[model samples]
Target: MVAFALAAVFFLALCLSAREDRRRFRNAVLFGLTFISLSVALLLQLDKVPNWVAYPIVLAVFAVPTLGTLALGVFLIGNGVTMVRKEGRRPANLLSMLAGLGIFGMIALLMVVQMAGSRVLDGIVGTLAVIVAYISFLFLCFLGYAFLYGRIRVRGDVDHVVMLGSGLIGGDRVPPLLASRLRKGQDIYEAQLARGGRPPVLLPSGGKGSDEKVAEARAMADWLIAQGVPAEHITLEDRSTTTEENMLFSREIMTADDPGYRCVVVTNNFHAFRAAMMARKAGVNGQVLGSPTAKYYWPSATIREFVAVFWEHRAVNLGICGLLIALGTAATLTT
Candidate 1:
């Protein structure tokens, strides 16, 4: 009953926090806690249930982690191979494959430690296991919350639809990835107009890269213009070199015109949540929307995004990991 009550509290907190500000990373933590507390409450009541129900639950509790990890490892490995073949040999493209291989490697290490029975090996494996578990939990929280955040609709009318830019192909042409963002932004703008709301400004935000012939925002603006967006409605912000910059510079332009402007920032689906976090940090009054991404590319890209988010919060993450390691080491030594 106490566990169930705890879960209820966590759920309520999660709902309130998410409602108050969907961009907060704390919302993800609350969401994860709600799920975990509920799971624990369920497991605690298993003993009072019928044997048939309890048996399957017991089997699942033990079997799911191993089986799920194996399945995930295989899927990521396959996706990684596809990414390498279809995308290229870039390090970014190899993330999924490397993560998959790391899973397998950990499993093998566990097996070897079981056979060796060395105290040192046990301590090392235990430390690694705890760290991995912490990271995996955080990743699950991020993945689940990101999915939920993506589904949320923009409330009321927005004054601008800011489409974030990706690198151009041929140093001038907008690639399919970036084109998707422009299309989504246009759709939002048209939808607002069709609904009898004011037509929002279309703001394409990015800068020229050393390898690019023209600024990314300029290329994106040209694409939008060709698609029939009015020159008067288009605002180009061609100074941002990163996602944080995209939000900050776009905020400056929007706020300059109307200090209390509301807007939506657009990026690829894999990047939407992190971009939202950046928007909040930049003091932008906006929600973020995601454009569709290629199916084959999403896993690696999503992993890359998670890595960035993890590093962004590295101080707390590393502290927790270090504590877990110390505890694991102490336990192993004492035994």
Candidate 2:
């Protein structure tokens, strides 16, 4: 009952945090955390037979991949039809269509693996479960870190600042995602200026996309200048097409005179951790700052970011999961 109660409490916490609107990943993980915590609690209360039974039940739960596969199928069919009708099957759209179909193929492969191997591979059934459990744990680690890291704020002196650009709507104007970043960056920039710091160079780093009328960096630079930030203080690095490019290009411009610079990367609050990871990869030694994000977009966006990070270092991630699974399988086998 105590474990159940704690699980319920965490589940509630997850729901509350999900209300941040745009952060779908955080909310989904919160709900997941609640469910797993409850499962862990229930495991503590069960005897051996029940514990054994729980494993199969969890195995059955893996069948949700079918539902995901179905969803993918339907979406791809609809998207393909629309794309074919509207664009006459463009190469890029066709690639997206193929990717969607490829997901269903993966689901099909897993289903076949389960069905054909169910008899003799029953031993490895537990093995698979252990592997999956650890993968879930890997997800949990990222979700936990992302949640906690989102709460941290950069509230002090800084010499250099980078407002990492999110894409804008209609190719020119600041969308809410990018706007939130700029506002946060501006606030930090103003705060520093007020505290007798002359003015930190605000690097708005993004190149213009083919679809966009102007570069995002220039838009951000203009916004800052109008907010009473002096023209000389805002250096626009207007040629980065991606986040890595944004960081690398901005750093190159900022560190043109001095390579060793202390700085903060400003982005949406939900993006702070991934941005920190990116900055670390780019060899930038600075903390990250997140501004307010809309509630709805964050969950899906943050989850996508988390998956990207995990896959970015898949060997390490897979190795850690492998270790955990090995341990769990041995423990289960022994018991």
Candidate 3:
């Protein structure tokens, strides 16, 4: 019953997370499965559940960590291959490939260990493996939830809106990506004023492309001013090519009045978490808000964010994978 209850609760959390934040959906699926598996394993320990009933139920629960890790492993390997080929041997690219391969190797090793053992130690190892798997899954689930909560909470209190830019379409117009960021920023700016908050500053941050006519920052700043934002309320950060620089350089203007500040970052929905991560890295103290995105672009974008997160904490991700394989292998050999 406790097992079922836990599973039910985790499931509910996932459903809510997925519905509200698509970036969380993949993590949510794996998380819910892990929770359900643990719940069943707990149930199997009951005297009321017979070996015949309990063993299979336990087996099903135990399968999630191994299988989930295996799937993630394969994905990493595939992405690694793609990364190496497309990006050459740049250090960053190599790191990505290595991380992906690390997942693949761990999962593959676990499967091999499972295949080789059927003893008492094997059962023990299997149980341990499942625990580790559940832990990793939960961590990812928590990460998604934390980012979501932070995004929502911070946006709700935002008094200043910053739109980080990408390239413009045809070197002249707002692409969907940039437009999403701009619109969300504008909306929040208006909302704050409507609620009697003093007029929020709207900062459009981006530089020009090598072949472009105008800086994205200037273009976006103009767009907002045309929409009735007083020219005085707009700040143009016309010299940042990367997201990090966008926040850093913008922070200069943002803090020109006072070095200490709280502001809201605006980006596409799929990008909110990563953008927030960048904000933290750039030493900008603030939360992130997201604008809507077209459906077709989300999968690739979300995957990119996951990869970025993995890189952001390489030792932790790989260490967890290593521990899972070791525990699973040891328990299998022992039980």
lDDT of 3 by residue, 1-335 (tens): 66466666666776775554433334445464756566665765667877888776666656765587667666655665665565465655454446557566655666777888757645655655576555556546645554554456443445467898888877767776787788888888888888877887888999999977899998898778777889998878899998989989988888895566678888887777778667867777677777887654443455566667666666876787677777766756654
Q: In model 2, what is the error at residue 248, expressed in angstroms?
A: 1.1
TM-score for candidate 1, please give it.
0.97
Q: CA lDDT, every prediction?
A: 0.93, 0.71, 0.70
In model 1, the worst 10-residue window by lDDT is 57-66
Candidate 1 achieves a global lDDT of: 0.93
Best by TM-score: 1
**Error at 133, model 1, angstroms:** 0.4
On a 0 to 100 scale, what is the lDDT of residue 176 in model 2?
Answer: 72
User: Against the hidden true structure, what lDDT does model 3 obtain?
Assistant: 0.70
TM per prediction:
0.97, 0.62, 0.61
Clash number for model 3? 12
Give the alpha carbon lDDT tens digit for every residue of 212-267 in model 1.
Answer: 99999999999999999999999999998988899999999999999989899999
Model 2: ten consecutive residues of lowest lDDT: 19-28
Candidates arranged by TM-score, highest first: 1, 2, 3
- Can you write out model 2's per-residue Cα lDDT over 206-296, one digit (the tens) per residue? 8998888899898888777777778888888899998889888877876884677778889887677777777767777577788886553
Model 3's C-alpha root-mean-square deviation from the true structure amounts to 7.9
